[model samples]
Target: MVAGILMSLRELRNIYELLFCDGVIVAKDDRRPQSQHPEVQGVTNLQVIQALRSLKSRGYVRESYVWRHHYWYLTDEGIHFLRQYLHLPTDIVPGSLRRVSKATARGRAPVAQSGPIPRPEGQTDRQQYRRIQRLSVDKLTGVELGSKPTPKPG
Candidate 1:
């Protein structure tokens, strides 16, 4: 029973990623080492497709046609569900959730911020969203710091 629930939750997380990212461009966005392909490696396009089908049953995600490829996005209900799950501020609607691939000398489990604790059966979507958000914030913070404040020319 626990395993079944966990499986469902994993699918849910995948759906969220697809929806949040506005559907990963199958032919563009070549930033990762695995970006140049029919699908990104490690990220597993099949897993994402499976998750999309599963979440379609829940009516939270929908597919759209853009030229020759399909795009994914959250329905209003889906967005609402994410907001509730993440306990986000009433005014904080997420813009997007892009995936980041860190090239570790060896694969390491990426650390993330603590959010709403999981339901023991491994409800990982909220946690994963928090993790993604934290990473984005950290990246932006680094960029901000790395950039010079500005030239104080007299």
Candidate 2:
């Protein structure tokens, strides 16, 4: 129980930093291909929700849904809280895809990567799956199990 709470708190902090670095956070979508929308390994969608719920209740974050997607944004309070928590000066506010600071560039993460995204090659179903002919267990080949023979067709 204690470990779970500790993990949740750590996830909450990680999520806070994510929102700090990127102005907005979008909930994970399983409908899309993972390759197209690869998720960061440390946090799962469920954990993001659990952490966001705590932040939302405290007025630190605002939530919205658009085009069947959930988006979370850090409020002013959230920014202030994060800055305070990290002992960062209040002047260093970075927006989405903005460079945080020159001094911290060594530890900075790129907001976006340049270059065309590689698309996966298409494959036919037959190429992906093997077809195996198996006998049906529901009934025998010539007659239904535990049933009298049908009357002769007239």
Best by lDDT: 2
The models' CA-based lDDT, in order, is 0.54, 0.63
Off by over 4 Å in 1: 1-18, 21-41, 65-68, 96-154
lDDT per residue as tens, model 2, 1-154: 1213334556566767777877677885333322222334566665665566677888888999777666888888888888987677867774764665754677766556577544336745553343211224323465545668879999
Model 2 / residue 97 / CA error / Å: 9.6
Would you give me the overall lDDT of model 2? 0.63
lDDT by residue (tens digit), candidate 1, 68-117: 54456677787777777655565655454434466342476666869866
For each candidate in turn, the TM-score is: 0.38, 0.49
Give the CA lDDT, 0 to 100, for residue 96 in model 1: 48
Q: Which stretch of 10 consecutive residues in model 2 shows the poorest summed lDDT?
A: 130-139
Off by over 4 Å in 2: 1-9, 29-39, 97-154
Residue 1's lDDT within candidate 1 is 14
